[model samples]
Target chain A: MGNIFRFIARYHLFLLFAVFQSVALVLTFSNRSYHRSWFWNTTQEGTATILEAYTAAEEYVHLRKTNRALAEENARLRGLVEDSKYIGTVKRGGRKDTLQQYTYTAAHVINISFHKRNNYITIDRGFLHGIKPGQGVICPTGVVGVVNQVSRHYSSVIPLLHSRTRLSGSMSKTKHFGSVIWQGGNHRRAQMLDVPRQANIQLGDWVVSDTRSAMFPSGLRIGKVAAFSLDPESQSYVVDVRLSVDFASLQMVYVIDNLLKKEQVRLEESSAQEPE
Target chain B: MRHPLSALLWSIVALFFQVFVLGNVQLFGYLNPYLYPIIFILWPLSWNRATGLIVAFLMGFTIDFFEHSGGLQASAATLLFMIRPWIVRAVAPRSEMESMPLTLQAMGQPKFLTYTGMSLLIFHLWLFWWEAFDFFELFSILFRSILSAGVATVLVYTIQLFSLKSE
Candidate 1:
């Protein structure tokens, strides 16, 4: 007992290190997605909006140019709606849906964080303003992230820069599905894995969210395919996607709220419970 | 021996300067240099465990409140700080540590840099390691810790160098 006591007393620091490390690991694992620390969220967003407004005051003078750009965008969107009604890649798939499942509400980016391996962004709205978790966030160009956590007046989004954030996305032309994840290296480049090797991917092929994702509507823009190669061992293609929305330059984004997703999930759950 | 309280005052000043001032400065893009741990690094060697734990916890929790990672930074920082005495004893002799605060001036150049290097590496290595739970990408985590710590160490050294010159 004395020998044991002496050994422990002598090497107590290493023991403490191990114990502390284990506890910290447990804490990290349990909070895998991220615990929205409400203290800084409001301050960060509020401060950023103020700063942005102050800086963008000059840009505000060119309102006519902005108006023209928005009008052009609205017209292009109208064209897409018209074109999709008759001729889209998803001919039978989108039509089979009896009702609209998702809706996109546009909001300006209040704040953003990207240096950390698990980063998040804050938009200008929250639950009081009809925002919720699991909503898909996107810039006009491509997908940003799905909403992970929410506070009363603000919410944090798990951006594409985070290693934990993976989206079911696909090629815009070939319609190949793969999981898109941030490689934790660069903000602009994301990794798309689990793609079948048979798919002929080109350098500039467009990638978009697949129908598999409940939050994002099928075919919402993701990124351009930067690179792809076959994994010799597993025979799967690993595609590197250049994110369309540069998180560093995010100004405004639209949050797509899938109103019918919960109903759809519940229906699927109950149907799967048929005593099989 | 010079009054220990004055040396202790330097520790407090370091914490103050680090938290309220230098902590706000983001240099070299993502690197934020924090020297508050210098308080733990320089705790009077004669302090008892109860005082040590309390002081360490306060220092860590204060930063945690600012960083807003729930209780994570506090938990990790306090844990690292609590073990500092043992780290000092293990790495350096008690007689050398007796009345003096641990600093380059007290420990001399050779021992001081080595001690600080070891302590900082241990603290940061544990920090980023525990951050991800497991070795998701072990090499990358280690590289990040080393890179960030290297930059932080240089910043600390530069600050100390400049402050010493001013004094």
Candidate 2:
């Protein structure tokens, strides 16, 4: 008994170190999903105090621009809902056209970074504010980006200015569809590849987001096509597009929360239940 | 009169500042200045090893909780504190190397300051390199460590000067 007791005392320090290292390993490895971490609560509390000190300072400096942007957004949204009522074509003597429907929640940009190769923007709204991953963000003029990461008090968005930002967009008048990608050279310009030459297109032709997106509603204004050419390297046509949102001047945005997202996802998920 | 209690108190203050205040002020993206572990560096030569290790563990664990890096800092800090006695002995002045205070009063300003600064650089190198687990991109890792160390070294020196002045 005495011998065993002495051995335990001698090895206690090594055992303690092992315990601590294993705890660390669990923290690093076990929690790959961002949702699992308590980082949100802690970061929110800390940033709240920090941002409070900056809010008063921002009021006098950022007031005029923010107000004008909000007024412009309000005017544009009213026009979209009131004027452009999409008509449904009847097939087999029946027609189904959902009304112009979209819900918008105002969010303030808290922290943003475009310097990184994989850029992300964090806003001052989160799960509590009806913000979720895959929701589209927009400024007064056009589409901003999509929410990629979300927490209780903050959500990180991948901006349209990123080198890898991609969206499903199409030309307005012509039935031309292409994939939008940022060249990283300029914040305002994104290039669309995979366009077919069969469709009619022009330089100043308007382009907007499509219904193909799982989250963003159809016809959200993207930008205007800037330049186009049949690439010599590849047969597919490529067009330079000028995005609407000025990321440098971005202050406020609206997080669009689709009411039908949950029901749509559940229906798709259940259909995959059958064995392969 | 002995000053062990004062040293312990200052170390707690340093740890609090590092974990709470400095964690929020991220300079760019990856760089986080960890000045708390320097409390072990500035301890008097005669300060106990057990105290240094305990203080280092607490400091590292506090940082771990905030950064979600469980034991990486703790392990590096313990390793640094363990080797601190030998580094101090090697760099100390030949004449006043065995003195109790081991400060400028005992070993002149130049010799004592050189010893303190060099040992600190070595500690920073060990902590940052090990914390990163010797990745291939070692240049940027070392650069960040040096920049953070320079700022932290100034903070430590200021604290020491103020403490000495008060005394």
Candidate 3:
């Protein structure tokens, strides 16, 4: 008994090291996924408050640019409204009500990081603003990310710059679809994998979100194809696309609220649960 | 010897700088220069080992909290704290370490560089290793670790130089 006590007393530091190291390692590995505990995320009250205040201060510097973007978006929206009125007046038959498939909620980007393998953006809108996880986020130029987690007053989005983020993209001209994925180390570009070689893909072709996407509405702009090469093993084109959204300069964004998302998710989950 | 409160105050300053300032400075995509480990490196030699470890843990935890990095920084900093005493003993004689601040002025440039380089290397290696977390990209992990460590070492030295000049 005395010998055991001596051994433990002599190696107490080592034992303490082991205990602390294990705790840290566990936290590191467990929190890699988007579904990490809210307690450790930026949405935690103290961290969120600090980041929010910092972003509020920084927003002053970019106010003019943000106002310009907002003005341009408003002009485009007005043009669309005029075009819709012309179409309504020209129609001979009784008025056909257009279904609104998606709603957009404006939010302020409180904090963002594009340098990490899995980058995330925090927006000021949260559950209070009807924001939910798995909803898409976008700016005036193009798609930005998907909401990954939400707290009471803030939400974190997993942007396309993240290595783990994968979205379904389609060529605007040919409608050939591929998987757009970020291959860490670059913020301006992402790769569209599994595109067929004979799809007539061309340089500068526009890539947009496909109809099969659950997070984003079909036809939302993603990027332009910057480069392409055939994969020898898969015999498919690995296309590099230049993202349209300037992640670094992002300030104001819109979170998409898919009204039918719950129904779609339920249907998909049920189908997936069936045995082969 | 500096008072414990002063050490505590310096630690808070370093932690704030790391989270608010250095955390945002990413160069060439993967090189994040972490200068917070300097807090542990400069911890008083005469401080209790358990107290030092606790301080290291808290410092790391606070940084991680701000960065939303889970515990990557925390684990790396704690490991550095655990091995710091041995590293100090290995680099300097016992008599020279009595209440001496771990800085270039006190320990000479070469010895201080060696001590900082070794500890920072270990800290960065563990940090990027867990960050990548995959053996498949062995070369990338090694490159990131070395590059980041190099940048961080230079930055820490520059900070030390400026502080000495101010003094």
TM-score of chain B of each: 0.75, 0.80, 0.91
Query: 2 or 3: which has the higher TM-score?
Result: 3
Task: Indicate which candidate wins on DockQ.
Answer: 3
Task: Summing lDDT over every window of 10 consecutive residues in candidate 3 chain B, give the lowest-scoring window.
Answer: B63-72
- For model 1, residues B61-159, the per-residue Cα lDDT tens digits are 455433333345556566767666667777678777666667667676667666666666666676655554456677766776777666666655665
Off by over 4 Å in 2: A1-18, A31-96, A99-102, A108-127, A131-276, B1-32, B44-139, B154-167
Report the error of model 1 at residue A19, Å.
9.9
Cand. 2 Cα-lDDT: 0.66
- Greater DockQ among 1 and 2 belongs to 1
Stretches off by above 4 angstroms in model 3 are A1-7, A32-43, A79-91, A94-97, B89-100
Q: Give a tens-digit lDDT track for model 2, residues A1-276.
A: 999889878876555555555554454343335324576456544754455455446545888988998898777768766356654545565655685346888887765544222345667887888887789898777888998667677777788765446888888887678888774435677888888877678888888887566567777778888888997776778988888777656678888877777777777778778578
Candidate 3 positional error at A245, Å = 1.3
Report the error of model 3 at residue B165, Å.
Answer: 3.1
Global Cα lDDT for candidate 3: 0.83
Clashes of each: 0, 0, 0
Clashes of 3: 0
Candidate 2 CAPRI category: incorrect
By TM-score, the better pick of 1 and 3 is 3
Query: RMSD to native for every prediction?
Result: 6.2, 7.8, 2.9
> Which candidate gets the maximum TM-score versus the true structure?
3
